[model samples]
Target: MAKIEPGNGLTSAVSRNILRGTTESLALTDGEGNSFGSDSELNAYTSERQTDKYGFIGGAQQYSEQSAENIPPEVLRQREAKWLDMLNNWDKWMAKRHKKMKLRCQKGIPPSLRGRAWLYLSGGKVKREQHKGKFEELDSQAGDPKWVDVIERDLHRQFPFHEMFVAREGHGQQDLYRVLKAYTLHRPEEGYCQAQAPIAAVLLMHMPAEDAFWGLVQICEKYLPGYYSAGLEAIQLDGEILFALLKRVSPLAHRHLKKHNMDPILYMTEWFMCAFSRTLPWASVLRVWDMFFCEGVKIIFRVGLVLLKCMLGSQDKLKTCQGQYETMELLKTIDTRYMQEGFLVREILELPVSERDIEKEHLASVRRWKETRGELHCKALPRMHGAKAIMAAEPPSRQDLRQNPTIIVELPLATKSNGEDKERKKTKEEKNGKKNSSPTPVVADLEPSKPPPPLKDTALLGSNQSLSSTEHDTYL
Candidate 1:
């Protein structure tokens, strides 16, 4: 387990001073012509210190941290696999194992055992019949070449620091492009999506291209159902549910947030969407990936909710909306105590029934909302507003106020105005039943005679180099 220290933000002197409300100051020279240090022999004449561990003060210690990467590759990595086996059987082993799967994964399955594991655990063994002979058929089509352009758009930006993805016109980059391009050709409906990046990066360490491509296909189709959809609306809804759980469990933090106008999007969004890849330790992250292969998307929600419980107070509410998109920025510095609790895994497995019960609640809430809509005369509210009106609108058999969540979650005095006050602005216009701002110029704008241009996805992978870029651009 990698150790992490807590204390939010940069932790430098400048940040500490700002937190202390101190004015910035700097002094130059001995203006009074006196030495602050003693002139005694030892104090005046010692040599500069040299130590390996210290960092951040710009001496030998600082130099070492910046240069740690310069250590021989053998140091950061063990050399046991120098001329290792060239195939993988991990997936087969993993599928049959009952325990310590996370342990076996980190010891680095040798190359000989790597490819098969990548394929089998990928759920690709079952897909062999479905995709085995398809690449050649795909290449025979005119559009086969076009998928390369799309593949290129995502790969270089996926894990740009890795040798396999260094944004170069080289063998590794070309091999990645070929596999993704072939996969896209093989499954046009699921042509591509951002989910494949970390998956591909992990596989490239062990498996060859062809096998890895099939595994990627299996992961998307079998494990993540809404894998390639635009805007990821399905995943976003899961986020809303996760946020609701966080509020219920950590209400004080939740209330503190409402006081500060923070949305859960400020921290929990990426933790759910990306499964804490950037929030937890890298090895811990691999543990998640392994379980993800075994259980599917439900584990993502479960593991994410568990991580949110683990990282309780570090979540800040004041960050801007754009800042909420990734977890790494906030998580890299969260105190280890957040994840250090010894009871985490058991607690997760034993999580409160209410926390993980969203599936049942979602449908019930939907039906109740629809029932309320049918009985509009009870109250005038939006399609999904007011638990009471919704309950009243439902069938007579379901009309008890005790069965309704609005009464349970809120007092009976609740009307729309009070229930939403903590969550929304109590604006003068909203109170007066008028629009807050002037209406947009609803001028007679003619619809275009021809259809508009096809929508393009510009969320090309890892580079925040620019948030949006099209099919042809490259960071290089």
Candidate 2:
């Protein structure tokens, strides 16, 4: 096979290392099939280089981890304890003390707890439990050839510079492959989009493959339906909403866009699709995600607006960008000053972009699109906004905590054939009079015993399938 190099507008410098020689590196295998290389090899390469906390090999190391490191260890322990308590009683905090939850999220979930917090926040834990073994089943099956081929090609392209994905066909890339390919199998209609690679790569960085797969599921189906779907109609609608909101949030920037006839799609596609994983500094990306999994897609909008405001909100700032190309370039290569986590997170939280505001614009945009362009090709399901809404729709139970603990573990595959295996084990246990060893069966906890009172801010919108439901277990 011919060697594929970086700078082809396809692969990256790190990926070039993987694609360097013979067809051997390109060959696929069953499990852990990426080319063999040692982390020691990658480490030696970066030994003299400056790497940020997330372990990207090089660059200016734009985001600082020193602030987090500089904190007293005791303070770090205290934060971890607080996060632990919150995770232990997540439903209570979500149901009543969501304001405090939001406050904690803004402060930033402890890095150690970030993965579990995200799983809980996105309701992926519930989805994972409700459909146990689903990921393994999908992993076992051969996915659509078309999607599988595309996914294989795109795996190395995601976060190629980061240690997790730096090695050729390393564990990081393997796990990333499993999550992305599993998603394609789970939601064949949506299939694979190149942008999802980075999103899944980020998730895998923080969580195990199964947990990461469910997290990706929640993102595609519950959080941003129609986003990765055919025609990407939902994103197009969101882009319009972002542009309309920009008119109010930053008129100068909005006018600058209008003056140049710059459509949001021209610049915002990668930003929105990847949720700024590719755009923002590493620390800033995590900060945004800390809120995003808790607050939903509105956080994405706020971050984008903040970037617009910082970059072109003023006449003076806009003066240098007189043409579309300059404006595009500025948006593409965001100023590092605005990329700092503290400044970026502060601006994002301070911005008054409410959920209602986004929904209102969405309604208007959808109506306008229908009147002008007719119905969209893809029909997106309505989604709960964030942790609060997701929890509101399907209240977690004490029994659930006992049965499905938050700590990551490989769940038993809940397939029909596995049911027989479970029965056999149950029968043997019963003969031995070890019935008590089995977990106590609880009443169906899909719907809360009492419906949660409506939230003050905005009403929860149920997706076509509730996160707690088992009917569409295949999807999540």
Best by lDDT: 2
Residue 447 Cα positional deviation in candidate 1, in Å, after optimal superposition: 69
Q: For model 2, how many clashes?
A: 0
lDDT for every model?
0.40, 0.73
* lDDT measured at residue 361 in model 1 versus the true structure, 0 to 100: 49
Model 2 ranges with Cα > 4 A deviation: 1-43, 60-70, 403-476
Q: Measured by C-alpha RMSD in angstroms, how accurate is candidate 1?
A: 29.1
Positional deviation of residue 422's Cα in model 2 after best superposition, in angstroms? 40
Residue 292 in candidate 1, Cα distance off native in Å = 1.3
**lDDT by residue for model 1 (101-205), tens:** 433433333233344444444545435434456655553455554556555554544333233343344344555665666666666654655445556655544
Q: Clashes in each model (backbone N, CA, C under 3 Å)?
A: 12, 0
Output the lDDT of residue 333, model 2: 71
lDDT of 2: 0.73
On residues 356-472, what C-alpha lDDT tens digit does candidate 2 reach at each position? 999999999999989988877677878668888877787766655433332122334344467788888779778988755534333322222332233246322421111222222
- What TM-score against the true fold does each predicted structure earn? 0.47, 0.76
